[model samples]
Target: MTTSVRGDQLARLLGRWHALPGRRRSPDYAALAAAVRGLLTDGRLALGVRLPAERELAEALAISRTTVSAAYRALRETGHLTSRRGAGSWTTLPHGHRVASSGLWAPDDDLDMIDLGVAASAAPVELVHAARAAADDLPRYLGSSGYHPIGLPELRAAVADGYTARGVPTSAEQILITSGTQQALDLVLRLSVPAGAPVLVETPTYPNALAALAARRARISTHGLDIDHGWDGEMLLGALRQTRPRMAYLIPEFHNPTGHLMPAELRERLVATAHSTGTELIVDEAFVDLPLDDPAMPPPVAVFDRHSRVTSIGGMSKPYWGGLRIGWVRASAPLVQRLAAIRVGVDMASPVLEQLVAVHLLRQSADIVAARRAQLRFRRDALVEALRDQLPEWRFRIPGGGVTLWAELDGPISSALSRAAEDVGVRLAPGPRFGLDGTLERFVRLPFTLAADDLTEAVRRLASVRHDLDHAARPTWRTPTVIA
Candidate 1:
C-alpha cells in the first residue's frame, strides 16, 4: 500500500530544495529535516509514500550517511515519518489527518462551511451605492462601441490623480485599467519576460504570480523574506546583481501571507538596485489601503523610481471589494500602450460600468480606507486572541496590516490539518500553496477577513481536530489515491 519515491525523483526534488533559503550557521541535518518536512507539508511527499533507504538518499545527496540518518530520525521523532522493523520508512501525517473534499478556495455548496482560504470579505455598502451610481452613468458611454481597451478616460485620470496625490506624480497617460491585479500581472509578464528568461520573486510570495511567471516559462530566481525581520536587503541585492533578471515581482506595501511592510529605505534601495541592474520591478499594491495600524505608509515604490523601471499594480479587490473587478497598472505611457495592445487578444476592455464604479470608489478612498482598517483590526485582534486562548502551541506574528496571519504550526501537519478541517466544514489553505517549491509545510495562512464569531468557531473546530490528530493511533498505509 505504500508508494515508494524513485531515487532519481528524490534527487531532482532535492535539487530544487537547495534553492530554499537558510540561515548561515544552521547544521546540514537540520536543513535536510526542514526540507523534508516542507515536502511532506506541501504534498510533494504524499502521506504513506515510502522514502528511499537512508544510504540511498545519502548517496543521492552526496552527504554523509550520518547526516541522512540524523535527519530521518528527527523527522520520525516529530511524527512526520514512521518505520517498521523490516519495512522501510514511509511518509505519514501524525494521527487524525483527513483529506479535505473540496479543493482550496473552491466554493462549497454547504451553507455552514467556514472559508478561511480567501483573504476577502463582503463588499462594502459604498460599493453597492457606487454600482447604483455607475448604472446611472452608463448612458453617457452608450454613444460609443463601449470597448475602451485602454480604459475609460475618466477612470484612468482618477487613478493617476490618486497616485499624484500620494506624491507619485502620475499622469493619465501612465495608467492602464484592467479587470484586476491578476490580469495586470499576466499582461506585464507576457509583455516583459521572454520564455526561459530569468524572473526574480520573493520566497513565500503570492502563488498566482508564480503561476503567471511559470506560464510564461520564466526561469524563476527567489530571495527569502524573513518572518521576523521582513526582507533581507543584502540578500535581495546580491540576487539582483547575480541573476540580473528581466523582472522582479514584489509585494512591498503589506506582503501577502506575511504582512511585513517593506521599510522606506529598503524600498528606495531596491528601486535603485533594480534600476542599476535593468531588472524591472513589478510592485503589487493590492493591500496598500488596508493598513490596520499605520495610516501613513510610505509612498509607492514608483515614488522612489526616477527611471521607468518600477511598475505599480493597484486594485480594489482587497480594500473595497473583490467583486468590483477593477485594477490598474501604473507605468510609462509606452508600456501602458504595449500592455493594452497585448490585452486585445484577451478581453478587449474592462467593463465600462465597473470602471465607473472604481472611479466612484477612488473618490471616496479616505472613508473606505478608514472603515476597512477599523473592521480588519477588530477581526484580526479577535482571531489572534482566540488562537492564543485555544491553540497556544501555534506561533504567529500579529501582522501590522493585511487580511491574513501567517502562523507556524508546532508540527509539520498543515496539509493534514487542512484536509481534516475541511471534513468539519472548514475550508483551509495548506502552507505550501504559497511557496513555489512546496516548502512552508510548518505554516498556514489564516485570514481575519471573516466575521469575529466565524473566526472563533473556526479556531475551535481546528483545536478539536488537532486533539484528535495528536491522540489517535498511527494510521496504516492504504493504496495511494490520486488527488484530482
Candidate 2:
C-alpha cells in the first residue's frame, strides 16, 4: 500500500514496461492503452505509485515529450491511471475517479504506435477467402430464428472434431460456443466462481482474465510459474494446498507472456490434486496451436484427467484473427449446458455469421496452422538473432512453441529501462507484467508477431537506448557502494 517514489522504488513499480517483441515502431494509442490496461488489471502497477516525470521519461524513452504526455493523458482519461501537477501520476482504483474518455483517436496524426503488446499476427489470406465463402451459405440459415445461442451446429461439430483430432475425443454436445475466448472465460467464471470466492490464477496469467474475474469481485490468489524451469509442479501443488481455491485457472499450453508448456507429469499431478481438493481446473489453450512447427505438440491437460474436473477453452483469436472472436469451451455435457445457460443471460449466443465463418476455416485447420507456424517461426528466429546480436548482455529462455520470448535482462533496469523504452516511441511489457512478487523484474516477453523490417528497426532503437544509458552511467561505476 506504500507509494513508490523515484529511483529503485519507482523502478520496481515500472515492471514490464519494455516494448513487446515483433514491432518495428510504436503502436497507436489504442494498442498502447490496451497494453497498459493489461498491466493495470494484472496488478502489475500497484494501486498508487507515482509515474516518472513525463518530460524526463520522454527523454529517457527518446521520443518527444508530447508523446509521453499524451499517453499519460490518455491513460488518465481511461480511469486506469491519474496525474497531479506536483504529486506526479499514479494508477487509480476503478472507483476512485473515472478517467475522462479521450475520444477514439491519438492526439497526433503521425504517431504510428506499433504495439508489441499482443502476441498475435493478422489471420492468413486463406482464412479471409474462406470467410467470404462462408458468407454465401449464411442466407440458408436466415430461415431459422437466427437466435442460435447454442452456436451453429456445424461449428460446434468442427470444434469437437478438432479436439478429438488432437487426442481429446469430444462430442459436439460437450461444446458451448461463445463469441470469443473472452466471452467464453466470462461465461465459465459465471458458471463456477461465486462472488468473493477465492480464485487461483497463475502469476502473470493473461491480464484480460484478471479484468473479467476482478469485475465479478472474485478474490484472487496468484501461484508462481518459474519461467526458468517452465512450470514447477511443486510450487503449484504448494499453492493449491495452501489456498484451497474454488478453482485454479491456467494456460497449460504455450502460456501467455512466458510461453511455457505445462509438463505432462505436472499436469497429471495437478489433476490428482484438483480431484482431491475439489477444485475446478480451467486450462486455456488459446495458443496451443501456435508453435511455428511441431503440429503434434503436447496434449491438452483435459485428456489426462481422471474426473470431469477440467474445463478446456479454445479460441480462433490467437491462432486466427483477433477480430474473429469465436471460441468454445469443452466440458462435461451437464457443465456445457450450464455454461450455455450462463451465456444466454450475458450475450445470448455467439453471432451466427462468425460461427459460420469459423466452420469453414476449421475445415482447413491443418493448412492454416502450417502457414501460421512457418511465418511465426521466421519472425521468432529473427527476433532471437536480433536480440543475441544487439543485447547479448541479456539472457533468455528460447520458447519452443509460442510467439514470445521470456528474457532475462542483464541489469536491474527492468523498470527504468521500460520508462526509457517508452520515451523512444517504443512500447514494451516489462518482466513483472507476468508476475506479482517482482520475481520477473529482470525478465521481458518479446513477441514475434511483427514484420521483419519493423522488427529490425525496433531492436535497433532498443539497443541504442541501452548503449546510451550504459555510456552515461560509466563514470559512476568506479565509485564505492556508498561513496557517492
Candidate 3:
C-alpha cells in the first residue's frame, strides 16, 4: 500500500505529530480498545489525523507489524480509526458511545487498572486516623441540620492559619469553604466572569477550567508557557498588556502539567501587569504542596498585590485525600461574600462532616505535608531514572516538584504512541490536552505519583511499544489524503 508522500502534505503533518506516554508495564490485547478510546476522549488524538501505516510504524519502533495491525483494527472497530482501501488509515472522532462506552469498565471492575490520570496520592495515615476520630464528633453538628455553607469556624480558622504560616495574613471571614477545589473554581468563575469578556489563561492549562469558563460564555485567550524554559515572563506581561483581559487564571507554584514555577519576581510583575490592565487574577494552588523538594516558592500571588486584584484557590484533593471533598476560596471580604451568595444556588451547603474531617486533617497538615513530600519525591526520582534509561530519545527537564513530567517526545509520535500504548493496558494525557488546537502535540505529561512498582511497569511497557514502532516496515502510501 505505497502512496506517494507529497512534500507539502508531509510538511503539513510533520510538526503536528505527537507521541502519548504509556502507563502500563505490559501489553494486554483485550484492554487495548478501551484505552485507545480514552485517548480519543481526552483529546490526545483527534479525528481525521492520519496514523502511520502499521509496518512503517512497527519498523520505526522495532516491533512486530502484527501488534500494530491488531491495535489499529481494534481502534477501527471502535470508530476511532477509519481505513480506506488505498488512502491508508486516519484517526477519527468517536461517533457514538455505543462502541467506546460499552468497552469501558468501571475502575472497580478492572482490579488491575492504575489511574495515573489523577494527581492525588493515597490518603495520609494520620489524617485517616484523625478523620475517624472526628466522625465520632459528627453527631454534635447534627443538631443544626448540618447546613454549614461558610464552613465550621474551626476549619476556616485552620485555613486562615495556613495562610498566615505561609506569610499571608488572613481572617476566617475572608474564607468561603466549598465542595472541592473544582467548586471553588466554579464559584469564583460565576462571581467574577462577565459573559463574552476575554479571560487570560496559560496554554497547556487545566482543561476543566477552560470548559467552565467557556460554559459561562467567556472567551479565553491563552499565553503559552515555554515548555523548554518554563513560562516566559516577558511574553505573559505582554499578553496582559495587549489583551487587558477581564480575568487571568494562574497556577504559579508547582504549575500543572509543565511544573513551571513563575519566579517570585515574575509573580509580582504578573500581579502588577493585571492591575495595570484592571484585570483580576485567579490563582489555583492545587499542586503547590506536591513538590519533589521543598524549594522556597514565592509568596502566593495574592500576597504581593497591594491593589487586591488576586483571588486564591486551594483544595484538599491534591495535598490530602481527594475523598475529603473540601476546598475553599480566600479573597477580599466583599468577594468572599459574593461567592458565598452565588454558591447557595449550586448546593444549599457543603457536607458538615467532611468539613469537620478536613479541620481535623488541617491540624495535622504539617505532618501530612512532610510525609507526602517525601513519598512524591521518591516517585519523581524513580520515573526520571526510568525515562533516562528506557526512553533516552525523549527530552525533559527534571521538575523541582510536581506529580507529572512534561516531556518533549523529540518526534511526532504522540498519537501513534497513544494508540500503540493502548494495545497494552496503558493510558495517557497527550500534550494537546493542555493546549488549544493541539499546539503542544509533541509534549506529554507523565504522572510520577503512581506506585513505584506500577511506574516501573508502565515505563517498561512504553519502551516495548516504542521498540515495536521503531522497527515496523515503511509503507509506500505514507501521505494520507486529507478528507475534504
Give the least accurate 10-residue stretch of model 2, judged by summed lDDT: 475-484
Cα lDDT for residue 317, candidate 3: 85
- How many backbone clashes are present in model 3? 36
Compared with the true structure, what per-residue lDDT tens digits does model 1 show for residues 225-290?
877887999999899999999999999877988998998888999999998999999999998878
For model 1 the TM-score comes to 0.80
Tens-place lDDT per residue, model 2, 49-152, is 67677766655545566766777777877676777777788866544633235211122222554456556788788877887988898999999888877788
Clashes of each: 1, 21, 36
**Which candidate, 1 or 3, has the higher TM-score?**
1
lDDT against the true structure, per candidate, is 0.82, 0.72, 0.73
Candidate 2 error regions (>4 Å): 1-112, 293-296, 437-439, 469-484
Q: How displaced is residue 75 in candidate 1, in Å? A: 23
Error of 3 at 405 (Å): 1.4
Instruction: Tell me the spans in candidate 3 whose CA falls farther than 4 Å from its real position.
Output: 1-41, 44-108, 470-484
Residue lDDT tens for model 3, 103-155 = 33233334554445556677888876876878898988877877777778888
Question: What are the root-mean-square deviations of the candidates from the true structure over C-alphas?
Answer: 7.9, 10.0, 9.0
Worst 10 residues of 1 by lDDT: 475-484
